[model samples]
Target chain A: MGAVTTPKQDRSRATRQRLLESAVACLAEHGWAGSTVTVVAEHAGVSRGAAQHHFPTREDLFTGAVEYVAEERSAALRALPVQGRTAVVAALVDLYTGPLFRAALQLWVAASNEAQLRPRVTELEARVGRETHRIAVELLRADETRPGVRETVQGLLDMARGLGLANVLTDDTARRRRVVAQWARLLDEALG
Target chain B: MGAVTTPKQDRSRATRQRLLESAVACLAEHGWAGSTVTVVAEHAGVSRGAAQHHFPTREDLFTGAVEYVAEERSAALRALPVQGRTAVVAALVDLYTGPLFRAALQLWVAASNEAQLRPRVTELEARVGRETHRIAVELLRADETRPGVRETVQGLLDMARGLGLANVLTDDTARRRRVVAQWARLLDEALG
Candidate 1:
């Protein structure tokens, strides 16, 4: 028999979603330091008690928010058409150049200061890395790239992540575009 | 005739240096938030009041620390022999694969959260980009490097900064070697 859907389970899921949404907004405006439980609760239109009931602690709330983002991002990434190296690189660039990436960047910066949040942030980052590597491996297979070239491509991806964060903070749009273009060129030169 | 060194000036310079050293050690041991004034003072064998006498606030301390680190790093980078594309890439990798690079990674992760700290980190980061571009322009001198190659190369350097942070945290010797090797290889291919 199929498992029954409990009312409590549904409500719990809603509360979790509320917290995650509230967290993204709060984190964007007030940054990590100002993103307290009370503030997030108010932002979410939920009571402090309800917020705590769901998240338990500020650290838990932040981790949940990041996990929520990563899951959503992972889904989007999975949906991208990874037919060839060019397509794959374009999708990865789009992912980094979008709003979701901005949110992830903000969270990472905030987590850098909070000692309790490091493990969670690091783990989420690792998971993202693994997913990206998997996509890269698949792209390599499709392109018939040598093993050494596949490894080199993964390294470029890592470099792209680091550059993307720096680019997001830049004020010059033209400059940012150029950075992404350079990434594409590097891929074409080394892997394509 | 020589210019006289006032006691106040000497004391100010000494206090500033102590605070920088303490901040470095504190950050190394405990990350960003842990580099509080109380801990810094204790680390430097000075009273809390003495540390405050030099740095009025934590932000000031952090800003001074960033500038001090930037100067030190710039000096080291300047000292490197970066005549050709290969030497340039090798010097860049050597820069990141050392203790100075580790210190930079620490400061970077810490600075990400505090918006006030962002400009300082970004400024130093931009300078690094500009310097790299200068070296690339001088070395490559190739007009065919698409309009924004310099900017992209700079962004890649920033990404290297983040990846280096991830690398240090993972504490994997193989990963570190791989990152540097890939970076070197990519640079060789892109500029060679």
Candidate 2:
């Protein structure tokens, strides 16, 4: 009985994971408008009924996908090699400017006017924000207990997100590189 | 000829201005999905034909609205009272976290997935970005000739935009104030 139930659970989890990844891809490529249940199911090679079974509504699907990607991103951040401040900052910039950020931006815009999606998005953003801040604080070796240190950390995160927004609309790589370098310098000066 | 056409031209300009303002209001309140031409025209108290005559297309309407709002915001920035560094920073934060930023965030998200809208949004953003940077540099009286000075200006703008993004999803007023203050302190130290 245990073996049979475990295999079934594993298959169900795999299907759900595939659906979530497909949802993220749809979001990144097509934005909120194009990320439909039918499309996601097709992309995931799952039946519409199966997708519905996993996610009852579009909001549920989107929220699940966002949380899924955030967890993946957080795990990836934690796995990043311990490097110099410049390298770490560059890595963080790359993460923020990538597809995950794009997907999240789409949701952010949708949630701006959507009453139902707002709470979910806000909660997810706060959770992700805290995790990312934690990782960044560790990487920068900043003393969070200091008076201005936490704000500096938050400021850096804000700056990175803003740079990512610019990158979404324009080829902001050069400017982003320079900004990351400057911020690294500032962080070093403040933390030291 | 000048006198005779002036009144008619003025009327047309007023109608167009009303439509653009309505469009911005629609974007800020309703997000991209609800900001249809019909809704904007209704919001502006203009006929559908008249709205179409003024904007030609939905993209035109949105692009026009964004540009109109950017110009208005730029004017407001230019008119801000010159005060101490903290005051100026506070003003900058207010501008970024205001309705214009919310409206622009919607456009940014839409433009990310919209090929035709991307160029227009990107160009408008660059123009607005430059103007904001110029105003900030003047307000701070920072030496643009220095190597890191320009980056600092860019970084502050980026941080403000990032904070605005956060504010969109969450009630981040307290944290935003602190981040702005910390960044201002850092700027004063570097520029002084």
Candidate 3:
């Protein structure tokens, strides 16, 4: 009985998971103005009532959604197999080019101009930013104790985000590949 | 009278300019949902009818506004004096940190999800992107004809945008300065 859940509880858990995933997807595909709770509920294959049960208001839903995306990204990062620098850089860059990044971007834009959503996203950002930085340091085997090294690692991350931003409006593939490959070499020189 | 504007035409031009500037400011301060034609009209000290006369619809206002921003930014970039690499990098990064960047960012997020606004922003982005790249090439004294040199320069611009994204919600001054400085050193190594 220690880890067992009743069927009723299991069903409830599934519904909540679906809601969170669908909310982010909806937000990514449709801006905040177009993505409504009902839209999300329909996307999740759950009733609006059930979605409301998990998150009462739009703010509650987005707050939960952002946390979920962060957890998923961190998990994805940790699961990356230890690899060569080029492969690792490519993988890290991939993190910012996907749907999760798009969803987070929407939230960031929303948070910037949204008063009610600002504090929560800001708090989440600080936490997530620190966590990602620590993970990057680990993955890069970056010894930030060395002068200029910390900023180098951060510069790499910022470049990754910049590449991601470039991709937002159009397919930044061919050019992005060049930039990514070039960054791997830079990482070698700068990290050393 | 060869190049001079008539008084009535000058007033109309001023009102149009005011509307464009106000729309961007409103978009930056308040997300797309909160920023309305009426709101921008109020901010610009123009009557709603006057704003409507200049911009028939919300899309018209945003399209015109985004163009105005791109022109302003390009003009600002052209006005920068030839400077040291660090100063050049810092100035380029500054272009992405201020209100114009904020306004453009909101439009990007909105356009990503709003199909109606997509093509126009995409067109403007490509135009503005190419122009900025050309300016950066000249300012950096970057010889892109060299292998990998083009990507190196592009990387610097993307890094600047990424730093701007990081600054959207919080003041990223301290870390940003470090990243910008580090890129200056990286440029010296990579470009050479």
Candidate 4:
């Protein structure tokens, strides 16, 4: 039988979801140093106690936030239309240029130095990386067994990420459109 | 005669140099949070007062570190043999995968969130980015007058950065070699 949710339980779940979303947004804007639990709680419009109840520590909150957004992004990727290479490439590139990526970037920078947060971020990033690669393979219909095909697809994702990095300081849209177009052409040739 | 340096002046100059190098190394290893002036001074084997003397604030120390290494990297890039596209691509990619890049990445992550540090880092990054682009053009012999050539060069640099980010988690050496090779081929065709 399908499980039924009570009103109180549904409300609690919604609050938790809001907190997670709010935390990601906070991390994206504030980095680890500035994104405190109280601040995130305030941003979420939830009490500090409620945030603490959901996430016992700062590490749990940020890591949980990244994982939540990553799952949401994966779902979004899965739901994308089966458009051709150009559209698929643009979608993948968009993944890195968005708030989720910004949040994850902050987490990565923090985890690189924070001993306590390192392993969790490492594992989360690996899982997210693998998921994105797998999706790219499926979406592009790439057979990794073929010579250079895996690298080509992987290269496309890396190039997208590089574009995202370039966009961090300035709007790289004009150059990015040209780059994306060229990558689409490259992917068409290389993937085939 | 050129002005002769006294022993005290020479020692002070060496101390300042040591502090700058140590600051970069510390930022690369420990990142922004753990990289205090006292820590950098200890790493450089200088007194805290001496470190403070060289850089009056944390902002000064880290910014000076990035600037110092950037100058060094620019000189090194300039001295590279006008190798063919493949070797030049490999060398360019190597720039992102090195310690200097690691240090710069940390600084960027910090600057993205820290209001006080943002403007300086943004200016430094822009200068470095432009310098690298100019060098890449000169090395590749790609005339920017031709359309898509600029984006091609920029794409390669972005891919190199993505590869650098990938390597942050694990050794992406084998995959990167293949990607770099493919990029060299792409560059050959696109540049022509």
Candidate 5:
């Protein structure tokens, strides 16, 4: 038999989804300090009690929200068109330089100092990082067993992240484009 | 005549130096929020009035502190022993994966959210970044006029920073060592 979708259950699920989305928005726009349950509940237009019932504490809320966002980002990365090497590099650059990165940056900074939040953030970051690496490998059709291939992948990801960090403070669009293009050329030479 | 060092002037200079060092220590351990003038002054074994006399405001304090730290780091980088490529890479890795990077990470996170701090942080970061890049270029003995040499320099710095970011939450020492070795190999291949 098919699963039943009762109105009350649907409403509960919708409320949880809203809270998660609101929490990510808060993190992206106002950073870790501003992403309180009360703020998220208000942003989601839900009652504080409802938000608490959905996510018992700030940790629970952030943990759920990061997982939700990571899944969304993973799916988006998987869906990217692999037309050519340049295209793949550009898409990865766009992905790393976007809101997902900003939201994750907030968590990274907060988790660096917050002992209670560190384990969860580290777990989520590792899972998401692995998935992204896998996607990049697949997109580039890179041979994992080849000498220097894995390091190249690591280097590319690290370069993207560094550029994203620069973008956090300055308008590094032109420089980022140039760097990506040059790296893409180097990758092409290496992998060809 | 050479500038005369009065006892009062010497004491004032020492207090300021202590405060700056304390500020960097607080940043590395506690992040930006805990690196207040009062906290730094206390950490330095100085009075709040003395801290204010030297710094005037939190912005001034942080700005001066960052500049002070950057100059110290620059001198340290210039003095690194040039044993070989692996040794240079290891030293660079050690430089990035230390307290300096942690303190800078705190400022980068704070500057991302604070408009008032953004300009100062951005300017200082750019200046420090250029100096670091110049040092890396010198260490690598890279030809700046070469087509891809500058990008290679930039790539190395960016990769170090990205690895530093990863190290903030996880013990990425093993992975960082592997990446640095692989990158050193690639750099040798390219530059040789």
Candidate 6:
């Protein structure tokens, strides 16, 4: 009985996973204006009814994408080896360099036009704020050098979003790296 | 003949100005997605034909709106009393506190969806970057102690944008004031 139940659960999970992956691909390729529920259904190789069953509307699909992107980002953050400051900076830069960041950027562009989507987008933002703030507060708690360091981290994160957008548009690796190192030093100074 | 020339020139310029103003208001009120050429024409109390004569398409109208917004921001920046760093910080905070910023934000949201609009948006961004960089370079040149100052100024400016956005959403005067002081201190450190 247990063996039979395990494969059944796995199949269900795989289906859900497939749907999420398809949504991200569709979002990146078409953006929100061009990515509709029917299109997503076609892209996912599922019936329209199946896509609708998973995500009732375009907004629901976008909401799922936002949550999916956040979970992926948080997972990436967790995988980072937080041994040194440089390590952390490298991890942060790597986070922005990958496909997930690109998909998130596409969602951000989509969210800008759709008022209904802003809440979902901002909800993820608040999640990042609180979670990132917790990490900053913990990191600085042991150090006596810099106070008000959490705000510095938050500011870096915010600026990095704009920088990330610029990176996508211009492909300026040097400037992006400059932003990362400069922000790291600022964090250290603030910590001190 | 002189009277006719003055009024004709003034009338033509006023029609152009009114069209621009109406575009901004329509954008702010209806968002970029909702604001159509017909809607802007209605807002300006002009016929659709007249609006079309002035702005051939929706993209052109939006382009005009962006230019108008940039000019408004420039005018505001010029009016700032650059007597001291503190006043300068106040001006920076003030820049994002009102309707113009809201309209600009709306356009940003809109531009993300419209491929045709992105170039116009990038041009504006480049113009602002160059102008701001020039100002920072000038200040750094004047100050003897500030070395590698451009990076610091740019980072501080980026941080100031986040602070200003927070201020706009929360009406948090105290927070804005603190950010202003922090910005001023950061500037002093970079310049001194």
Best candidate, TM-score: 3
Task: Give one digit per residue, the lDDT tens place, for model 5 in A8-117.
Answer: 98999999999989988888777786678999999999999999999999999988988888998899889998679888988887877777788788888888878888
Off by over 4 Å in 2: A1-5, B1-6
Chain A TM value for model 2: 0.93
Stretches of model 6 off by over 4 angstroms after superposition: A1-8, A93-115, A136-146, B1-5, B93-98, B105-113, B136-147, B161-180
Instruction: State each candidate's clash count.
Output: 2, 0, 0, 0, 0, 3
Candidate DockQ scores, in order = 0.38, 0.81, 0.85, 0.65, 0.65, 0.30
* Maximum-lDDT candidate: 3
Model 3 TM: 0.97
TM, every model = 0.81, 0.95, 0.97, 0.94, 0.93, 0.82
Clashing residue pairs, backbone N/CA/C < 3 A, model 1:
A162-B159, A163-B159
> Which is better, 3 or 4, measured by TM-score?
3
Candidate 4 residue lDDT tens string, B66-181: 89888987888899997899999999998888788888888888888888888898998889889989998999999999877787788888898888887765677887899888
Candidate 5 local lDDT, B1-192, one digit each (tens): 639998988988898889988998888887776678888989999999989999898989888878987898788889997778777877877776788788888888788878888899999999998999899889878898988778877877777778888888888998777778877877666666
**What are the per-residue Cα lDDT tens digits for candidate 2 across B1-192?**
465677879999899999999999999999887899999999999999999999999999999999988998889889988799988888888887878889988888888888989889998989998998998999888898988889888888888888889988777999888888988898788777
- The residue-level lDDT of candidate 5 at B108 comes to 84
Model 5 in CAPRI terms: which quality?
medium
lDDT of each: 0.67, 0.89, 0.91, 0.86, 0.84, 0.65
The C-alpha local distance difference test score for the whole of candidate 3 amounts to: 0.91
CAPRI-style quality class for the chain A–B interface of candidate 3: high
Local lDDT at B72 for model 3: 96
Interface RMSD of each: 3.8, 1.0, 0.9, 1.4, 1.3, 4.0
In model 5, what lDDT does residue B177 have?
A: 78
Estimate, for each residue in A1-192, the C-alpha lDDT of model 6 and write its tens digit: 565567767876666677787787776655555678788778777888877877888888867876887788777776655466645754665665555666675665445456788667866756865675555445334252445443455555545554554454345577656656766665556556
What part of the reference interface contacts, as a 0 to 1 fraction, does candidate 4 reproduce?
0.55
- Give the runs in model 5 whose Cα sits over 4 Å from its true position: A1-3, B1-3
- Give the higher-DockQ candidate: 1 or 6: 1
CAPRI level of candidate 4: medium
Ranking by TM-score: 3, 2, 4, 5, 6, 1
